[model samples]
Target: MPGRTRPIDKLAAAAAKCTKEGSVYGKCIMADYNNVHKDKCITEFLKLKECYLTAYKKR
Candidate 1:
């Protein structure tokens, strides 16, 4: 199982969203989306502090 490759199907499902230009899995470019994502994609991107909920009465 060492040095194995990942299946493409698993990547497709794991992707949060894709470029709607019929290029769902088109280009694999390096991007500096750290800032752009949090600002432009605010509605979807979750803030770091917002993810912690230890004191909310555990289920």
Candidate 2:
């Protein structure tokens, strides 16, 4: 496992690849932080999730 990446590292890499989507999702949530409405950022969250999945698969 000399050159293998740890699971946490892979997760971080996938997250890094989806930073833009994550940021959008985060902003959407922060926009209504106190309100806590459901599905308000579903679109953004889905995009981030997809990006992370794709990135993780590619690794």
Best by TM-score: 2
Q: lDDT of model 1 at residue 1?
A: 56
Q: Output the number of the lDDT-best candidate.
A: 2
TM-score of 1: 0.20
Clashing residue pairs found in predicted model 2: none
lDDT values for all models: 0.31, 0.91
Cα displacement (angstroms), candidate 1, residue 40, comes to 1.6
After aligning candidate 2 to the native by TM-score, how far in Å is the CA of 59 from where it should be? 0.9
lDDT of 2 by residue, 1-59 (tens): 89888999999989999889998999999987998877888899999999999999996
TM-score, candidate number 2:
0.82
lDDT of 2: 0.91
Badly placed stretches (over 4 Å) of model 2 are 1-4
TM-score of each: 0.20, 0.82
Candidate 1, residues 1-59, lDDT tens digits: the string is: 56764555434433423223213212211144343432453332323212222212121
Worst 10 residues of 2 by lDDT: 32-41
